[model samples]
Target: MTKTIRTNPLFELYIENNILVINNGEDLKNNGHIKTADIESIEFIRELNFWNKILEVTFGLIVSVKSEYVRIRFKDGFKDLLVTNCDRKKVEYLVYDVNLLILKTQNHHY
Candidate 1:
C-alpha cells in the first residue's frame, strides 16, 4: 500500500545525490544543505483543509480588472494572498469569498 503525503508551498524541498535540502520560511537564498537521511519528517501546514476549502469557495468575489494583493479577513484571523501568474480579478474574487467562508466556517467549526 502507498502512504499518502501532505505538503504546502511554504515548505521547500530539494534533493541532490545523498543530500536533502529543506527550506521553511527562512532566507530562501541561504538554504543550508544536509544529508537526505537526516530528514525524517516534513510538516507542511499551508495546505490545511481550512485554507484549501476557503480557496475553493472564494472563487468569484473580486471586482478588479487587474490582479492585486488581497487582504482576507476572517473571524479568527486573516491572510494575504498573492498567487503568481494568475488572473488578477479571479484571484481577488477568490480571496474575498474565501475570507467570508473563513468567517462562516470558523463560526460553525467552533
Candidate 2:
C-alpha cells in the first residue's frame, strides 16, 4: 500500500500499486487503476474569496480526466468525495496538491 496522500473523516486518498484509491470512511467507495494513457487531461484550480480587501479563504482542486470518471480532490482537510458526471469540462472549484496527483498518475505509466 502506498502512503496516503490525503485523509479526512469522510474519505482517504491514496495510490496503491498504481491504482488510485478513494476510501470513503470504512467502506470502499471507488478505486481507479490509473494509467497515464488513460488520463485525458489533468486540471488544477485555486479559489480565492475576498472580504474587506483581504483574502478570507483559499481552496484547491485537482481533477483527473479519464474516460470513465473524473477524479477530484479537494484540500486535504475535507471529508467529501465529490462524484459527478464524467464531463470533465464542467467541474469547478476544489483543491488539492496538484503536483502530487500529476506525479502519481504520470509516473505510473511505466
lDDT of 2 at 84: 32
Report the lDDT tens digits of candidate 2 across residue range 1-110. Answer: 33332344344444455345555443464543443334334443322233412432233334332222234433332233343322223222212333355666667866
- Candidate 1: segments with Cα more than 4 A from true spot: 1-12, 22-30, 47-110
Provide the lowest-lDDT 10-residue window in model 2.
Answer: 86-95
Off by over 4 Å in 2: 1-10, 26-36, 50-110
Worst 10 residues of 1 by lDDT: 1-10
Residue 54 CA displacement from its true place in model 1, Å: 8.1
How far residue 74's Cα lies from its native spot in candidate 1, in Å, is 34
Question: lDDT tens digits, residues 4-107, model 1?
Answer: 11134343334445453434443355345654233322221122245445655687432222322334333445333333333434443433433444445446
Evaluate all candidate structures by whole-model CA lDDT and list the values in order: 0.38, 0.38
Residue 9 in candidate 1, Cα distance off native in Å: 15
